[model samples]
Target chain A: MSMEGSIGQDGGSENWGPQVTRKSLMRGGLAALLVAPWTASTLGAGGGRESGGQDAEASGRTRGAGVTDDEIVLGVSAAFSGPSRGLGAELYRGATAYFNHVNANGGIEGRRITLKLYDDGYQPDPCVQNTMRLMLEDKVFLLFGYVGTPTVTRVLPILKKFQNEDIFLFFPFTGAQPQREPPYGDFAFNLRASYNQETAGLVDNLIRIGKRRIAVFYQIDAYGRSGWAGVRAALQKHGEKLAGEATYSRGEKFTGSMRKQVEILQGVSPDAVICIGAYAACAGFARDAVDLGLDVPIANLSFVGSENLLKLLTEGREDAGKYTRQLINSQVVPSYEDTSIPAVREYRELMARHDPQVPEELTREEYTPFAHSFGSLEGFLNARLLAEILRRLGPNPDRAGLEEAVFSVRDFDLGISEKVSFGPDRRQGLQSVYHTVVEEGRFVPLDDWGARFA
Target chain B: MSSASSGVRIRRLFQKTRFGIFAVFGLIVLSTSILCIYTVDTELTAEYEINIQNIAKTIADSSVGILLNRDLATLQSLVDQFLDVQGIEYIYITSESGEFLAHTFVPGIPEEILASDHGSTEPVERSLPGMGDFIEVGSPILAGVAGTAHVGMDLDVVALKIQRAIGQQVYLISVILVLGVLASIWFVNLAAKPLAELLAYAVELARDGEREDLADREILSRDDEAGHLARLFLHVARQGAGRGPAPGVGGRE
Candidate 1:
């Protein structure tokens, strides 16, 4: 396995050195040192760099921060620890696998892509600190692959605060609306569908199958609330409402009991329950709901990390099918098992080839990496779309042209069934949401929701 | 005066003086201990209440903008960090419409909080059924338009601190009382020794009428008031002895 060098925000590498270095790299190092103090002052907390103005002018080109002649360093702050670690770890693997393939094939216009990674543990404050470090200390070209809604929502303000520095967050792995709405929407380019779209599709399909009384079990944060709002709106369209609701805190582990939440939702006799939480909590809820005999269909959003959720539910269980029965998960990315899709075939091939590991320093907990997951597939597509944008930026890429380049991409095919398109009004690339169910120990796309669920 | 009776007189004086010292020191210790315990309990309880309220205010002030924007996620993050302060058991925020915006409850928002008065600006001390006592304080964000922030400080922790403080005060006061008793006993003995000896000498002289001299010269050295009085009495006694009972000789005269 070829390991790519990951530079931390402290200008240090994670045991792996960049194999691609240009003659100007030493000067770039010097320029970074001269640029650090100024960037540190301008961007106090979650601030961005202004770039070395005289240096860029001297070169007669608008050189962005974190971009040398030979490489572009992007920042990634996600949950590499805690209950959501699988999401972060797998997402990084997926993105890096694609990037590794790109770099191996003589790089993008002879410049290799590197990630300056930090662990936010799926928290907001640490995410904010990581963003500030990435922007000011590491001077990353842009922020990419931020994992959760809470972390990304907090980072949005920082992105807006440093918008003058031309810092944009690309394809965060959340379906939450904060990065999709106004005031903060312009700062992020999302590749995944919103939670509203996911919940609305779930609710709409469930309603079509006569499951009108829907209840929600959410993770009591912006992510949960976004899904809750989506469910509510979707139910209102059919002249119905949530039968009941329950919430759990973020960072709740799978071992923690969800009996109380189960009892709360069970009392209302909801026909179906939609969970908008991380894998651990959602799995716990599903386990307890089954153990307590709450016989109803349980649906989850894509953010749940469906593979990890199923793994927790079925791991060490004598009756795995009993727990996994009637479980539905909504996803923004197509199933990785569907190799008929060009991207899926490419993703599976590259994931096997690169097998990128979460940097050793970020792996605070022991996690067995999945060979292929929806999370990494989305990450692969994110990296693919970013590479396309960077390619469109031509041989000389600057942060100033990033937004225009992203917008200029119209009807771009990511080798998936859904065509990705972006414009001045549209910040999100893909708007389609797919639903799936467990079939033979894996999530397969549910072609006929009414037939299977009914 | 007979020596045996003189010794008895000194013993009686010592007993009386020691009893008086014990009584006085015992009362002082009891009163001081009560005062200290009261002071500690009152001060600690007041400080804890003030600290919790200040924390609630700080959270509310920081949450105003996030709440106004209706960013429940950031508002939750804002309130969640304050839980690290010791004794801060829970925190919750409400929107201007009196709906729950964010809270730090694990299972769910307790019905006690849901039913409690969000309109109250005053801090209310509550006994949550299973969660123990709390001094629930609220602060209005943006003059209550952005809604209210409530912080529940665990009163059990405050009570435990106060108990520890009071226990330490009692220990200190008890030690002081014991030391006071010991020093009082020694001081009383030192002060009453001369008087006790003088009384014994008088008793002897009343019984014997005369002696060659004061037996204990340390008490009759004519250096201070006790010495001068002892010497003067001895001289008068010798003179009277020389005059041989002028007023009432033998029986009644």
Candidate 2:
């Protein structure tokens, strides 16, 4: 409920304009009141529902009983309208395609999975509203593919309140620190590598390259703070303090502010630069650094991934190449650009059949497969997990029973990614990361960075 | 004819002279004022649109990098960052498959995203306010990853910025217009001074009955409209002078 936290999700900055005008401010206030009661009622109704099929549903053999004789529903929330709208849409596409394939495959347990999607716009208030709507009005059996750190963070409390009531939130897209920790973390599962793991892997790689004196350029936000903490922890293992650090507000386009930080790093003349920013800002920093004649090799977390960085450099291809060639990134998901991977092949086939219009040329880009692979893998895993829980739900199942079955899952593998196992203390259920570098505008796996973390 | 009738006619002629000069000055001032306001408004509006377009292009360029890279987290961060920018209201990203990915306020997933196959893993037409419909850039996440990254930047902010800029320009233009009106009045008076003097002399001659020298001095020298009017006035004055000349004409002797 902190305003700073809320700012990232609810278009908090949008309040400025309307607040400046009394007429619009009054209108906004009225709309909030009108929407408030509706949201409350929806949440109240969702909370009141409980099914008595717990015993039959908890046995771990139902496979697909969540969609039964009367209902077939699936739910998802993605950044439909916010900053990460592009990625949200891609993730949605991947999920939708999988659902299409499922529907085309005659569905599971003799019912079509009707996917009910809500646009949280990558903000929490709407995410909570949409989640409530999905559970109450849409009556989805479970929530799958929710995205964003602040978004997932906001809805966690509500989701936990409904946890015992049979609403299961699964496979959140963010790997924020608290999301991977205990207490606040429960019910949801994360397939992506935790920020800690990603940073640890990145630090390990930097050390392997014999690079010392690291500088961190990060967005001044939770995501950046989390990555910075991880970097600090990793650096501690080598007994080194950061050489230089600079921070910028998220979405800030100007690099002038970061120039001072770049100068500090240049003074130290670090061999590697650890940039924790979105594609544009990071690229901006890189371009700015190169402009200032600082040619350090750059490494970034999985947040930058490969596709975004390449696109960022594409504009300044010649300039970017001079510095980007030495760039490295850590990924939690399999590299889609690596066709040698079986998962990538299956994902490619799925995209072709269910969504053929997705350009075939994208396969050439390294990060294209990465996004597709992660999204497809998430869909495949969520489906597999749901199916496994359903099979355990027996002949008749309800929401509570589904939660029990899902939490009981141990050493489950969907063939595309790592085996997922969860216990009373462990809710995230997956912890692995892979390191990759951009070569010829494609992500090529360098090594299994997860093993280093372990 | 009575002496009183001639005196009354002379007074009436003086009144017409004042009215005619004022009318010419008013016409010049009004036309110039209207033209100045029109030109300034047009230029201001055009400049406002151009500024908005520039902002839009910047947003688009940044968005392209975010989308093509499939960096949702960074993209989300960018959205929050841009929220403070003068003219952006919301940002939305959709995948090539028409899957709503992330948005500013509304969750990217809606029933339409699940039901419609329009995006179908290909870059499709997506509509955004201000920017209209743009083709969502379809960047393959990886070799196997296929999806479109649809980004919507609410240009309302840009539009609003332009609006504010235009508002300021309007205030400035209003100031300029007031000055223009006053300057036009001063200029008209300065330019019409010589003509006013010529008309006064012709009126004096009509009253004084000065005839013999009036014909030569009062003839129109040029074919321009003002010159023709001058000649007509002189002819009328000469006729009046010729009819009653002897008293004032003794000076010529």
lDDT by residue for model 1 (A1-454), tens:
1243332234432112232233333333322223222122111111112221112222122246767665666888888889999999889889988988887886678666767777888987778767776776567788999999888988898888778989999999998777887768899999999988999999999998989989999987778877877888799899998898899989999999999999988888998999989999999999899999998899999999999999998888687787888899999998898888999999999999888887666676799999999999999999999999989888888899999999999999999988889988899999999999998788988888778867
Q: For residues B186-228, write the lDDT of model 1, one tens digit per residue.
A: 7876766667667666666676755554444556643556555
- Candidate 1 positional error at A359, Å: 2.8
Runs of candidate 2 exceeding 4 Å displacement: A1-71, A252-261, A264-268, A315-320, A356-387, A447-454, B1-253
Q: Which ten residues in a row have the lowest lDDT in candidate 2 chain B?
A: B1-10
TM-score of candidate 1 chain A against the true chain A? 0.88
Tell me the TM-score of each prediction against the true structure. Answer: 0.82, 0.52
Query: Candidate 2's error at A188, in angstroms?
Result: 1.3
Fraction of reference contacts reproduced per prediction?
Answer: 0.34, 0.00
Off by over 4 Å in 1: A1-64, B1-68, B95-98, B117-122, B139-147, B161-186, B196-216, B236-253
Question: Which lDDT value does model 2 have at A4?
Answer: 9
